[model samples]
Target: MTESDGDQPTRQRWILIRRSISGPDEITYYLACAPLDATVTDMVHIAGSRWKIEECFQSAKNECGLDQYEVRRYVGCYRHIILLFMLVQAFLAVMAV
Candidate 1:
């Protein structure tokens, strides 16, 4: 429901609770819950997003050598990544538009 700051990725969390009843005369009920409340479909979405990001990381690190930039200064690094992202955004916009 909330977007992460800047270009940072979003994180998903979920929790689930379930109850079961069994036995004879006196039925006994037990509760089982998962820490994450998300359903199977939601989990699949999270996993797919993670995999896509991982693929991007691989492409950037291995193919583009994104981290190989010679910018050692904080400002330089920030500017470099920002420009790279901007270019990517522009490219996407052009393609979509």
Candidate 2:
């Protein structure tokens, strides 16, 4: 693709779709197109992966007292995050049974 500053049509993006599988007999979707050059399918897949991370952040903020960490140092932040990850893993493990 040529980078033309004065081109509007060349700046457009297209969307395409495809089927995604989650589990047995379970099918989902993905999208793809060309223009902006990123496929919608890939975008959906990326977003789906990130959604779990977003949920983890929300859970940490809401339930793990993550905001209570007052120290601005990198060590403090890392310590807090490690502790929270351990706590979340334990919580999920317990819920699995």
Winning candidate number (lDDT) = 2
Collision pairs in model 2 = 16-32, 31-40, 31-41
- Listed in order, each prediction's TM-score against the native is 0.37, 0.42
| Winner by TM-score | 2
Q: Each candidate: what lDDT?
A: 0.53, 0.59
C-alpha root-mean-square deviation, candidate 2: 8.6
| Per-residue C-alpha lDDT of model 2 across residues 1-97, encoded as one tens digit per residue | 3334475544333333434555455554433334555555657667578658777766776666666657678997687775766588569757868
Clashing pairs in 1: 14-36, 14-37, 15-36, 15-37, 16-37
lDDT of 1 by residue, 77-97 (tens): 686774685466556557768
Residue 16 of model 2 has an lDDT of: 30
TM-score of the candidate numbered 1? 0.37
Model 1 lDDT-worst window of ten: 27-36
* Alpha-carbon shift of residue 40 in model 1 (angstroms): 2.5
